[model samples]
Target: MSSSTPAAPITGAAPSSLCAREPHVPAERLVAEMVPPPRFDSVRFSTYIPDPNQPSQTEAVQVLETFAAGLGGAHATGAGRRGFFGFGRAAKAPKAPSGPRGVYLDGGYGVGKTHLLASLWHATPAAPELKAFGTFVELTNLVGALGFQQTVKTLSGHRLLCIDEFELDDPGDTVLVSTLLGKLVEAGVALAATSNTLPGKLGEGRFAAADFLREIQGLSAHFRTLRIDGEDYRHRGLPEAPAPYADEQVTRAAHATEGASLDAFPELLAHLAKVHPSRYGALTDGVKAVCLTGVVPVPDQSTALRLVVLADRLYDREVPVLASGVPFDELFSEEMLKGGYRKKYFRAISRLTALARDAKRLVR
Candidate 1:
């Protein structure tokens, strides 16, 4: 952009020549640094994404636009746009704009639900009532630890939530989701989420069970549903490009920011709990690097481990971890990974992505 700017010296050239460089610089870090930390203060976080999910972000916008317009039936949405992310269509039921409870994206795995949700969250800034939550499944972990009623009370305070993993694994879980969602809508909290199942898709697929539908009915009454179908994205692997927001980046940033005075996770978690009821319980090592706080209980295990995992991941260029809860744990019990860490990773990304975007500006 600026031709007048001095060109960078050729590699292996004399060191003292580069003004941006100093007398004593680590050989490793000296190699072409990340654009010299930018001039003037920048967003507390880094904005120089090696590669951004622009295409994905664009598709997400289209999905939200369709949903926002009430393009399909009010309640039931027809399969409209199909892309790398998943399926999207406008719904018409409830007779209300998608604004009431936000847009609910429901469908099978390998669909671009999370990608779509991220797009919607980033673009729908005009609707202040539409608060985009990073993940919905994490709320479940909290609900299991804390009573659901209180969690609802907290979340009802917010206007919107962008939740991922909408399906409830436990039956008791369904009731909590039902009650919490019902109250939120009554109190005017619009909602949105990306899921691998349909509204009544949670319960037994065997009979298209009635009870599941009933529970989903109350919540469904206030919001609309969209189904994504077609070939699973997983059938094909992702292409290489700009580095993704790796858990490592989050952990690295968190660690880099560690010190006497800093914005801690407590505040972030509390805000989240007030919006969603599922985050709870705490780990023994109060030294956790990351965590979702402000729930009835706390997080299980130590919050630090998630940070550690993220920290290790931060250095890895292959799989970038954009967002994370805690960067403390590197090793997830095989069970945790199989059960829902897969789901949790997406949740982390959604959360971090929101946090990063919400910031005034990104720094080195």
Candidate 2:
């Protein structure tokens, strides 16, 4: 058996002398000082945890953590200080996980796939860490904006990554994703992802029903694959959208400040929210930015209140807006009313449409 000793104090006093060096650590501090987190700086350690405080992407953040922690040798127990992401070191470093490490999370719309993917992103630790982006288009879009080499470097830059809602419904995206994944995975990055499809099935226009399978297999081979099967947690039905609209707030807020006409929209919204300090869920695109005010499917909400008010005010002031959504003017007609809940739905839809009518002068 080995014995442990307290660290000596920083004082210059000699050990065992009159001012004999006091133990470096106080008895009170010993408990904390005794435990070192399981992983080192190079390797991250994490466990499944509820989303913390306020999140930029609520569901996505939590789901991602659960997936990455699943990769751990032993489920991470709450312990000492963890690395930046809190993911423990790989049972083995750099080596891929046994069986499969990739998860194919597919289901009806509304399942927390995005949330799961986001959590995985938070749990990953890359050198500079890979940049986390939403949607499949973003993967290749990065290639377009930064070029293939830089994109590969970005993925290589971080060993951990999560791509939210991957697999676009386009052949162009398919080609880019097919190519991008091969290079990114080959570059030594570990990826945990979520999609709306089963393994081998890619969402591309006119894809070789069979070759699509090959394309996925190509990527899946680079990492292990698991299907996150379950029901869609996202609420959906034959009618009206959800309120305060937790999901739509992000989407619509994106529409509010997008484009050249509303150049001052961001500052105006920020200043307007000075007293309240609202979380408008702004999405950053390098230098370009878009707030989520106008992205909501249903316009009634206090969530993106500031942005919506601004969008409405902008329209009143003749600030041309351009976006894509079924304007309430058209969406809530007698044809739509035939479907029902016209009262509550119409109020929200009309408000959103009014913003569109004001901001998007040129049919968004």
Candidate 3:
């Protein structure tokens, strides 16, 4: 027979010790802390500076307002319900005029489509239960995690769903999105989405002959498409490039930054693949300055996804990246565009271009 182990004496402060009590926090304050407003904290309409050169930009902002007004209703308080859930005096006020139920904000890379979508969400005042904001990639990822029907049912409660980077890179994703969009609309959910290509122009150059076009056609009808056109915002006022950095530097021991350089593209990718994002981010924490070489077209979907994470980290930290094998704009090959993560690729390209451009400018 085994003897039961005696419990150890409680060695820490007594339960009734004066230090044991947390400072008195009001119950109301505690409840408030538990629930917060939907994200998109960075984008606000008030800060969107209209490019004096592009008259269309002013119109784009107006479209964003209409999208926000539709779901938020008028006189909605707390920066369009982005803050506290409290129903203010205006909550009793009569509803404002409703606006468009569906809006598609289209533009080329770096043209601020995402900024507009974010602004609309932050400026709208849907009830806390009736609003959500996320990217197309995130939606697909969530569907993968929770299953399609469950995700749809969970999201259906929201009156407004703001999406960024609506892409059609895979037939499966197209089917899923079609079903989801159709159900959302049928349930009275308003959509405000941003994309690099117009609805009719989606899946071009990649799945041009795919049968999913029929579904896209049906979904497209729900949105009032608006093209926000201009030069690629990334290319404006960029610094000149220096001579290409040699690839041999990356093969050296200790991965020296003698030239303040980056590792070979393949090696960098291999390292990135082995770690999770938080660790990957920590690894690159000190990589404020580096040059990238052998930057050929992205080889595969997995690599492209890894590169997206790398690009996001680098961009957030304002790291300087120089390159050689390929231009930043041509980072992905035509073949890679057909993959399900094309939206991530597009985002990677935009971010890398901006990072490289800014890095050069800072160098000069």
Report the number of the highest-lDDT candidate. Answer: 3
lDDT of 2 by residue, 44-89 (tens): 2233232244242344444445655544342222232112233454
Per-residue CA lDDT of model 1 for 121-206, tens digit only, reads 44443343324344444555445444567556555555445666565655576777788777666554546777655564554432
Q: Comparing candidate 1 with candidate 2, which one achieves the higher lDDT?
A: 1
* Model 3 CA deviation exceeding 4 Å by range: 1-40, 73-100, 127-130, 208-210, 241-264, 271-294, 300-347, 360-364
Distance from true position, residue 269, model 3, in Å?
A: 2.9
Which pairs, if any, clash in model 3? 261-291, 262-291
Choose 1 or 2, whichever is better by TM-score: 2
Q: List residue ranges in candidate 1 displaced over 4 A.
A: 1-63, 66-102, 126-132, 144-149, 205-213, 230-364
- lDDT of candidate 1? 0.40
lDDT of each: 0.40, 0.39, 0.60
lDDT of 2 at 250: 32
Give the clash total for candidate 2. 41
lDDT of 3 by residue, 134-190 (tens): 656556655665577877777776767777778776677777888988777655567
Count of steric clashes across candidates, in order: 56, 41, 2
Candidate 1, residue 118: lDDT = 50
Local lDDT at 10 for model 2: 31
Cα distance off (Å), candidate 3, residue 17: 45
